[model samples]
Target: MRLLQTQITPFVNNFLHIDVREQPFLFCPLHGKPSFHAHPELELVFILEGFGKRIIGNQVTYYETGDMVFIGSGVPHIWLSDPAYYKQDSTLRSKVIVTYINPKVFESMFIHIKELDGVKEMINQAAKGINIFGDT
Candidate 1:
């Protein structure tokens, strides 16, 4: 990430969702670029198209289509798309579905509930980020 631009994640009805696509068009905008930002909401990201690098906490790694990751609340992260995706004549486009979970809501609804032990544990585990795979 080139910048630390932490800010309040805008939510639509207590959650934030971002989706983008391209047809036969050329040039794709940077999906979420140039920042290591953190917020109070937990994040889940599923990459449906393109490949690039991601920084979650101190972990800097590469990500491609079909990769799914969950980032805990307050963890700094960013997704930097490949250069070709931003090129004017390139056909490469990045598509991802990103969802943010409000911790206050999650805690009130699931974290402290008696029947949601598994969910509570999972949310706690997500504080360090997770890579979901295979039928999950």
Candidate 2:
């Protein structure tokens, strides 16, 4: 996958390497123009309020409030807000909560635990990106 100009180092150094970083309030406009980016860490994103299109690998999907997605390592993706959100007069805003996870860390802890097989499988699937739905 081609790496985008925006690298994930800041997030990695500031959040992932230390602990699972949970940013409960993320403003969208700060992300600027949507650009495809990839990183070696897995990410979980919850949209509290927003409307946009998400590009993950070959799939392009539209999303709004309450949309939650789990993206895997090295998978190129980005969330592009709707054009209206970029307008100066528009009051619309995008709010999100993001969590970054380093699968390698968990692997070291659970690799020998047979009980965590299901969890391991899920992590493997996340490498291709997973869109969580419903209340569960």
Provide the TM-score for each candidate, comma-separated: 0.78, 0.78
Model 2: per-residue Cα lDDT over 1-136, one tens digit each: 3447344545565446423222322332225445678777777888778887888888999988888888887888877778787777777766776777765676775768889988778878887789999974
Question: Could you tell me which residue pairs clash in candidate 1?
Answer: none
Cα lDDT of model 1 by residue, 36-130, tens digit: 66777777888877788888888889888789999888877777777767678887776777776777777887745789877778878887788
Number of clashing pairs per prediction, in order: 0, 0
Reference-based lDDT, residue 45, model 1:
82
Worst 10 residues of 1 by lDDT: 22-31
